[model samples]
Target: MAAPAAKQQGFYDCRDAWARTIEELAENDPRIVAVVNDSVGSSKLGGFQKKFPDRLVNVGIAEQNMVGVGAGLANGGRIPFVSAASCFLTGRALEQVKADIAYAGFNVKLVGQSSGVAYGELGPTHHSIEDFAWLRPLSNIKVVVPADSWETAEAVKWAAAYEGPVYIRLSRMPVPDLVVENRKFQPGKAETVRKGDDVTIIACGTMVHLAVQAAVELEAEGISARVLNMATISPLDEAAISAAASETGAIVTVEEANIHGGLGGAVAEHTSANLPVPIERMGFPGFVPTGSVEWLFDHFGLTATGIARSARKAIGRKRG
Candidate 1:
């Protein structure tokens, strides 16, 4: 079945929400400090710096040192939000993140900005597709990928109040707010955007809206496709995944990151152990070729049509 055309809506850059929410939190609490790798402009924390100059620390292109400084700040009772380009923040400073924050159990918020392919033509060297795979194994750190501006703000708020290590992945891509009634941000829980009986399309980060559109397309073709906004990747909503596998019988996992050791892998690991079901994983295979962000998404089948196609394939694989 062909995927239905997407309806246009107001788009938002989630980094703006992250910056605004953190500034608001800082206004109330003196302990809220932002540490960056000279990424005040990219992380959209310029306003934060202007409002609280003394609190915003720029580590000057040193990703590892920035993370270490964040850990030190946490040790001193300051809630430090380490912000940097996701590529460098996760790849260049992975050991610091695993050791200083995860293993040490610091009260730090690692904010990975411009995550995924938001870097566009900068190529795979700048793309952050490997971040989830790198950070997911660090059991102590909570991994979060917010779908839109609302979730981004909510995740920031939640991470601030929770005294533990957290990695909130944010993107500069413009996305429309999800249409969810009485929305509440519950970390490690899947938000059922659309209910169904045949198949479930689970997605995170920027791919969630595309999954919702795919579900709409499937509904028109008499295939009920449930859509889940899996904002939190690590410590996955296993209960929701189990119910989807038991009731829907088929699952399609999508993300803007690699299919390996990401949201798809998390869901697959759970379902494979508990409720065996037909599953289709969608995302980049590995190092993607250089292209515009739009091209990368379409080329890698991360769009509505692509997700709908995978949904059908998973449905076809279901045991009768």
Candidate 2:
């Protein structure tokens, strides 16, 4: 048997980073403001409201109009960060996101908080599994799922400074930090967390931690896996995907969204014609199950066991 894999230091929630970015950015640029649908507390914006009370616009329980209003704010030369639960922001105002923010090319940044199964006991209505499929089709909108607090802060800062529509996802679940404080946010670049040759593991958001764990477990099996924390889905790191496929010969893609059009689909889309290789996509299969978040993750094969199994399958599928 192979030796046990190494461990990281500690975990942190990206939501705190979101709040920090909001406060710091708003301090610098007066145009940087927040617009929530009565989600100041839920989205962890209470501190933000306290810090910049006049900069926040809370529209209670209205998602569609909330997005439109955000667009209007952007059109009026203000940087509006629309914060809300992902299930409501993406599902409720998907069309408005497409037309108002993306199609119109506004400078609105959509912050999807408590994404995936973060609201464990809140049921399926609170789950955000369709955001990938919903936003991936639209052009001009960058899709970002920061893996840790550092990445979250950097992505938000980058999105705010850069002009255009961007979707930045913030998770409430505790996650170990990945990049350093000096890590720069490149629009479509992939961050390599672990290097290997047997197989490559590509993941975004909370799935990134699982991929790191899977790398450790695979190391015990004498299997090497290259782990890439792919935070951007819309503008994929094609070079990294191609390199992973070419160097490792196999790839396993993971995400919290559905397997249909999320990071997995983006990887498959790139590898299809550029550098074809054995690929396995792991994520929600679109079936809302009745169980705890941990149970739901296990149900969808998102655990470390599931990720290792999928990595093994991908390695096995590699053509000699």
Candidate 3:
């Protein structure tokens, strides 16, 4: 497991990383095309548009049609990266996502921008807290939630090179870099961020950095907590989860979305079948009230302090 490095640099919005990666890939592969629902600025595709204006296809205000067009482009031998606000991208065009992309097995990279409560103030309608839950159950679709900018760039690269369907969740929220440079993105493998024995904390997306911080805090209290970055939610790293359950005796799962059918639920499903242990799932409990991302995290105990607290509670339960 990699130890958390000293706070490096300032916060960076992951969309920047996604944009840079897309442009780089486009430069190398002409087959790379971007399809968006009129979200050029929001998806951070202005530079890509400038470099390859002909490659950028904007299907204004029609998410369903936009996804359908992306699938069509894929059928025509072009690698279509469909980018849009996550809420509308997954919710409004779910049928198309299932039929045209996942079921049809098209090589389409679905980029859900501003995912989770990144658009917190935009109300629940805009909050993409259900994307993981929605996409996890589908077949032939890789569900990826990158932790930070570095992982975001790596994930985009993986999506481009790999064939078939993929959904890479990105955030507009700024976050410090978590994964180091040169670390390759391996699907269905959980990266161990911290190693310990008292308890294990498995987290995805925005919660990964917080889980690392929580493990750091747990170290001070003499409660060693193992932190696993479960970026791939669907084809979960069940081996790591089983190891954690057997070795640690307690596990705490975290995510930015609902606990039901999200990262937590995935972990629970695996552990229950293989190694049953005390598990506490942390996420938004119900309908999220409107507020800033910080407020929403606090409201639902999604912060590092909150994760550490859950870890302690899980540890106590194991002993009990």
lDDT for model 3 comes to 0.89
TM-score of 3: 0.95
Q: What is candidate 2's lDDT per residue for 1-320, written digit by digit as tens?
A: 11111334587878888898889989889999899998997788888899889989998899999999999999899999999999899999999999999999999999998888777666678888889888988878999999988888889999999899999977777778764334676778998888899999999999998898989999999999889989898878889998998899999999988889888988999899898998999988775766666677888899888999999998888776
Which regions of candidate 1 fall more than 4 Å away from where they truly are?
1-9
Ranking of candidates on TM-score, top first: 1, 3, 2
Query: Per-residue lDDT of 1-320 in model 3, one digit per residue for the tens?
Result: 01212334687888889999999999999999999988999899999999999999999999999999999999899999999999899999999999999999999999998888887776789888888888988868999999988889999999999999999999877788775445677887998888889999999888889999999999999999999989898787889999999999999999888888888888888888888899999998767987878788998899989999999999989855
TM-score of each: 0.97, 0.94, 0.95
Evaluated at residue 242, the lDDT of candidate 3 is 92
The runs of at least 3 residues in candidate 3 whose Cα sits more than 4 Å from the true structure, single-residue gaps closed, are: 1-9, 179-182
**Against the true structure, whose lDDT is highest?**
1
What is the Å distance of residue 172 in model 2 from its true position? 1.3
> Which residue pairs in model 3 clash with each other?
none
Clashing residue pairs in candidate 1 are: none
Worst lDDT 10-window in candidate 3: 1-10
